[model samples]
Target: MNARLVGSGSDTVVLAHGYGTDQSVWDKILPDLARHHRVLAFDWIFSGAVKDQDMFDPVKYSSLDAFADDLIALMEEVKPGPSVYINSEGYEGGFDISEVEQLLSSIESDFHSWASSFAPLGVDPNDPPSVTKFQNCLKRMRPETALSVAKLIFLGDQRDMLDKVTVPCTFVQTTNDFVVPNSVPGFMAKKIKGKSTVEVIEADGHFPQLTAHLQLLEVLRDVPGFDL
Candidate 1:
């Protein structure tokens, strides 16, 4: 894990990138976040940007639990004490298993073609630069690795795990995220044991941090500890 610690403050913000993206996806909002808090961003083992490709073992990491374990270890190594926690799940995460399988099939059949088409669908097509940026990120990944991670993300469900979350959370979503259905954030809020709220960024696409950073920042600022 290539973990970086930036800025200085009483609170820390860990910026975890989504599928098909590396920590650089947070570039648009990181600076402003750093102004008031410490920000930790890292590339997961499967990311092409990670220097240690050997670290990812598909057999061992077939679920999000493995990834969560890695994150816990990374946080311990970087910051040994307690910190604010944020995280998720589904009543409808947007796609069903069949839909996810179709996506996986497309990637396995032709990753390059899939990335080209998927990137525009994942982000705002009007934002050509962001689309290209996301597409490049997707293209950089090893197809086998990408497919494995995709299965973990798209097919895996953690709804049973939501009740275990006890920390305050603010679930953020875009107004029009093609990948995640609008109901997801609210559904998660209901499932989690913690006090939770949903914040909607008025934007198009699944990646608000990339295409709607300013709005994303505003939403982040409204989070309890991040108000500073």
Candidate 2:
């Protein structure tokens, strides 16, 4: 796990990048976030930025729980004390089984081509640079690793685990995300046992940190525990 800590504060914020993205995705908002809190960002095992290709095992990491375990271990070693935890999960994650299968099939058939086609759809097409940035992130990943991780993310259902989340959570979402449906944040808010709220940034893509960094940062700063 390639992890790094930035800034200094009594609070800590861990930046966990979504699928097909690395720690670099947070670059736009990192400086502002670091001004108030220690931010920890890292690349996932499946990420292309990882130098050690052998670190990822398809069989062992067939579920999101394995990834969560890796994060927990990383946090333990890094000792990012008393951080505000942010996460999202649910059965209603905006994609049906058929949709997921189609996406996986597309990636399996030709990942590079799929990534080029998918990147614009995921990010705002108007922001050509951000779209290209995301596409490059996708293209950098090993095909096999990308396919396996895609399966794990699209197929896995973790609705039962929501009730176990007893800490406060702030779900930041974009107004028009191609990947995640609008209903997800509300569904997750209702399911989790903790006090939770959804902050919708008036942005037009899945990656607001790239396309709408200022708005994303404003929302983060307003989150209850992060106000400091």
Candidate 3:
């Protein structure tokens, strides 16, 4: 649950990463963002960065609600005010239980193969170093943890929570995300209670922040409140 607070400013922004990767996913954009605002970045224990086993309780992490609660707690402790939540696709609203379950099953069966498949979908497949680095990152994730977290995502329905959200929110959708289909963003945009924007970026993959960092950063900067 430890987090790194970077930069120095009166305002605060929290960067949340999604499944299969850790806080480093935001590395491409952190420097620029940190120059103007304080950025809080942290790794979920299962993210493989936090090695302390005692920090994670298997039973507590069995659901995404637990993760949501932790996010609120982190915000309350650090920023304690209206904060922007820049989440990856699946972590936000608009998820189909069946589709996610199948994807999870595939990942559990072959983590490396499934992880590497992103290249063909739009990632830099030809780059040996980046490919190896991504593969190694996936390999660090235990299959059990992946399956458990996936189940937590697929089985959980967060639509009600969206109705409860009162802050200005933005959902960034990738053009060619294999895990989350094109329909998710629209579905989420309609369900959210507060003011929200669903931005469809030209990036072509689930992990656009890693594969298409510049384009993603451009889209993020243009987001209403995150222009900082």
**Best prediction by lDDT:** 2
Q: For model 1, which pairs clash?
A: none
What lDDT would each prediction earn against the true structure? 0.82, 0.85, 0.71
Estimate the overall C-alpha local distance difference test score of candidate 3: 0.71
Q: lDDT, candidate 3, residue 201?
A: 77
TM-score for each predicted model, relative to the true structure: 0.94, 0.95, 0.83
lDDT of 1: 0.82
What does the lDDT read for residue 180 in candidate 1?
A: 85
Off by over 4 Å in 3: 79-82, 91-131
TM-score winner between 1 and 3, please give it: 1
Score candidate 2 by TM-score against the native. Answer: 0.95
Clash count (model 3, backbone only):
0
Candidate order (TM-score): 2, 1, 3
Candidate 2 C-alpha error for residue 88, in Å: 8.4
Model 3: per-residue Cα lDDT over 85-140, one tens digit each: 66764754334667666677788788767767643443455445545655665556
Q: In order, what is each prediction's RMSD in angstroms?
A: 1.9, 1.6, 3.0
Q: Give me the displacement of residue 228 in model 3, in angstroms.
A: 3.8
Best by TM-score: 2
Model 3 Cα shift for residue 220 (angstroms): 2.4
